[model samples]
Target chain A: MKRLRTFIALAAVPLVLAGCGDLSNSSMSTNSGSSKSGSTQLTGQSTDSDYEGVIQSGHYQVSKSRGVTNTQDSGNTYNLKSFENGMLNVSKKVFSTKKYVFQEGQYLSSTTVQNWLDRKSKSNTTGLNPTDNGSKSASKRNPIYIQALEEQDYMTQKNNKLSLGGVTIGIAVNSVDYYKKTQYGATYETKITQAAGEAYAKKAANTVLKRLRQKSALKNVPIVIAVYRQASNDSLVGGNFLAYSTNKAGSTSVSKWTPLNVKNYTFPLSSGQSSPNSNDASSFSNFKSQVENFFPNLSGVTAQAQYDGKSLAGMHVNITTQFYSQTEIISFTQYLQTTAQKYLPSGVPIDITVSSTDGIQSFLSRTKNEKKFTSHVFNSY
Target chain B: MKRLRTFIALAAVPLVLAGCGDLSNSSMSTNSGSSKSGSTQLTGQSTDSDYEGVIQSGHYQVSKSRGVTNTQDSGNTYNLKSFENGMLNVSKKVFSTKKYVFQEGQYLSSTTVQNWLDRKSKSNTTGLNPTDNGSKSASKRNPIYIQALEEQDYMTQKNNKLSLGGVTIGIAVNSVDYYKKTQYGATYETKITQAAGEAYAKKAANTVLKRLRQKSALKNVPIVIAVYRQASNDSLVGGNFLAYSTNKAGSTSVSKWTPLNVKNYTFPLSSGQSSPNSNDASSFSNFKSQVENFFPNLSGVTAQAQYDGKSLAGMHVNITTQFYSQTEIISFTQYLQTTAQKYLPSGVPIDITVSSTDGIQSFLSRTKNEKKFTSHVFNSY
Candidate 1:
């Protein structure tokens, strides 16, 4: 059957989910080794484009974990998306998508996460954030550092049941701590230096690893911990991972920390501004120029480029046009694809979206190492 | 070109948009009466499935109008959608989709709408809801009756210029007015009866008509106006249109009003409760029973049925399953289509969405009067 073949493909495919529960009344269960591995059904669904959800290798059961979003504020949607995707990318580097099954973090409840994010006090010793000091002035008070925490678990089949194989935790630290003196007062901020934020993330990670170890099912598995420095309060884009560490099996703390020098930059920077990589900036500029010449009536052409250190990792180009004719749009998309292949950095993933005043027009994307882009044009009106 | 045919097809397609502006600095413009009407391009993109967007027939130019979302609160997303779609459905009855192109309401700016939504005062005479009585008690105070307003413009090509042909305005009135006594105090509400809300809406429509007549370009064209009763704050389903009217061409007032008795009820109505039409209710119950029999492992199978007066108009069935095997999913979808065709009302549009624990797996839908169902099985992992 067509459906069966699709399942077989995923079983061999390496993907993300990189979980543990007691045998009693737990969502995790075993098949008593009666069914062979080949009978395992691998089903997939991706809520976010930045990550791929693994198909479980057995009967379907709803996940029991309900993930939490801590300290959510206005205009934080972009941050939430990027933070989750960034963690998935980190997991991909350490855990193969083929071997691990994904599950939301079950060991931590929203209530527990809320308490841990709060300032330590007499009643709440579980708080990982710094304790509040007795100070009337905002400047004199200790800033609340940690923003939110995310947990992801990966499971592997062992003894005929899925068990915890690996865990990925993302710790989001605010660059600008948002606080209010009174409930109705204007929000105040405490600017945190990147060095201080990273240090706090490291401290928080240690506490998390120890806390997770308390669960018998999570004790001996490798834990991949990542630190994220959130964007400024008014940032249009989300934050990126600052550093990551993978403690070895049975370890209670991060074995080593690897710094990631990843940064996002907008193309055609404002006057007197330039990017770290001049070559990339020039390529994007030239691409924009050629596209502009094709459709002289375009509204705008812009791009968000992600650079890993000095090398371009991926680029998302947004082309806003005023053309509603599908012929003009298709011609434009085809031409743009050719232009992208010629101008963009080779071997880097490139995604270009064309949208009109109406809605999205077309999408042309090429994954890493791909020679040609895959294009899709929704049936135009 | 593969894209060329798509455009030609759409130029013949009939859809929603049912706008005028001063020639100077307006998005509307003329082509010196040279280009033939068939030379026009019609390309569409639907932001919502309940309404289809219209493709314009000319050189594409971005719309000048900036739409607004007023008094938006948590859990009002469903209300906004149903209100917009309900307005479109009303438009389809009076305006020919083939002759009109769609545009967002351009006459009423967000600032103007905001002023109109506020309680009438010296600083704001344009308010249409009511004047605040300054009552200290929450129950005695005048509720903020109006929640939001939406404008839709339809254009007809005239003398090589796309000009306003018709207009539809939707006024969303609150069933429960949410307000706080103090800035940081608890939210309070005053329940509004359907008769009271409907009367307020009619009064609002007259004001909107007079306001639009003040604009020289809008003084003469016919306008379709509809009033919507917003659902309760915690309601999962959106609100419905209460009534609608169309003033004759060149008329400044509504010719007559028509009442719409439409209500949405869940299938297998709560114990001891019955629907206006027992025949339709029983049909839905039989359909749900057949689906449950097919998959005993289902999480739930529920349907929302819409009745226009005493007749069944449409139904949306949601089936939550735990089957992840692509083969099993395909089999389930095929069986569902067969079951739906056998038991559902013969002449009503039906939509059944089957989603597993992962995400959406398959969709089976049949338009009103269509004999066979069209099904799509998303490629599962």
Candidate 2:
């Protein structure tokens, strides 16, 4: 129940550095400041594309260039400093995709996890006969990939009871790697044929299902197995995947398995759109780059998007950075919104949660239209 | 942003009656009774098709005929008495959909709102030209239809900025009616050609857009207008709707309007598998019926389901009753989940919230494969 209450944060990162800054804003004021009289009514005439139109009476002026400015008589102020800083450094990091395999492994060293598995195998050989024992545990080394994939709770719950009903299990067909080493850790080696990968993923998934069925609650849960064909060093998030489900005589026990149509399990923000089995890794990388470009000092960042079939439903982008002032956070949030509006197909709400290197966390949420913002600074750090 | 923090409850029903119940359970026990010695090892051999399998060591026993039975050494118990009561009288006021014109009137009566509009027109007259001024204050009679349509905040926000950037606005091609009167109070006679309905919905929607654009904050918001054809007195929840968007040259003002594919804006529980413009309404209705069937005294019920394009993202069901015991609530929740799993697409999280006529609110939530449930009861009535 606690888990249900706590919606998953966008990303998880290790503690790397510590920075300090208070969220105080000294410029907040309620007085309606009088704009400079006789100012030119730039009204749609400005050549600068960043021209943020003219401010109406009793409202704050939007700065074309960027800095905090209180143009309204009320306390409302337009802070563009963060936006300007981000724009100035827009080209610093161009978005790019990286190849990696999407699979589950605790983010332990490959040697460590393999050892753990060996020990478990020696102690209890009742289940978990890993067919792809031939393949190395390479995915364990990439913490981001591990976190992204493992966090998905594949089954659906009915009547308050958790079941594997209708969940399509995914298996990796071929070994994929992002690089020799990820920012989090080094990669392990893995190589398997497409047929072997399918056999391995399905077998691995069934092993999991078997364990679940042992429990009284999950015995009757329905599930499916899907195999994905991954190119060597391909992005783990996106790819064409095949689904296999059991043919039941009367919704009883399995009566052999049949292959379903090629279903796509896309990673969020990927460009592949809706391929039969794969996601475009390049699109997500570009999205990440664009996000990092807006922060003043981006340390490390992990962004995740959610898709319903091929339709992108929502996204959670967590940015890790050095100390950011309150104004900087606001500005960064605005910048992120502008970018999403430009790139993301509309109506998708994006949750931008920022965690400082020191562990301080803040959440900025935006939904299209209906001008209102929900944000909170967590001080537990 | 503050609005984002407050997720909408399933319904906003007016008080129709009052009910009462106490949250007491005299059946709390922590003893694990040993099974009868030499009992048949039902362990997987009972071919009784209704076999629910064995009970887990620390879990409760499941009754195939539906009754609460505790079989765990731990304090877990199967509270099925409530379930049985619910199933006994499943025909108690089944949740159904009502239809009304999807016009904006602040959910007030048509005549009252129109009169209000007339006053504003006489005093301000800056905008708001009422083309169809012949109708009186009739819509106020239909509260259910009004609440059903007005509560949808479909578009996501960027930061705190609400825009229609990617929301495909759905418009009904034919003016639909629920009956002679609606919950909010309306009885308007409408008979228009399909072309006329299209023209009216569009002009009305555009008028709304024009009014919104008058505000500086909403000037740059992007929106698409979708229209759907509905038979007179049809359910407003599901059906294929059409879409129309302007071809803006530079995200400024509308350049020219273009008709888009008939996009669907389905109400909960309708059917039209994943499509650009349809939803599965029947499934949701059945889910609702199954839920109501479990509750002893069900009053008014309002349920809503959300979809990302065609993929179901989540659902919110609010029920009003006289009173309920904790066990009864649990039974109802379990029934709801079971129905959802059987009917809904896998992995779509469902949020079931309940409100009692006595002014008590409870929320129970579950995600796939996650055994624990999140529930809290609040007495804010």
lDDT of 2 by residue, A274-367 (tens): 4331333344454465555443345355544444465654445566765323223333443344343333334655555566644433454556
* Chain B TM-score by candidate, in order shown: 0.82, 0.38
Q: What is the lDDT of residue A272 in candidate 2?
A: 38
Per model, state how many residue pairs clash.
Answer: 8, 70
Across B361-381, the per-residue lDDT of candidate 2 in tens digits comes to 445455554433333332100
By DockQ, the best candidate is 1
| DockQ of candidate 1 relative to the true structure | 0.03
Q: Is the docking of candidate 2 incorrect, acceptable, medium or high quality?
A: incorrect
| Model 2, residue A94: C-alpha shift (Å) | 41
True contacts kept of each: 0.00, 0.00
lDDT of 1 by residue, B84-176 (tens): 667767886777654565555767777888788888998899987688898746679899888877777777755545578888888889898
Ten residues in sequence with the least summed lDDT for candidate 1 chain B: B1-10
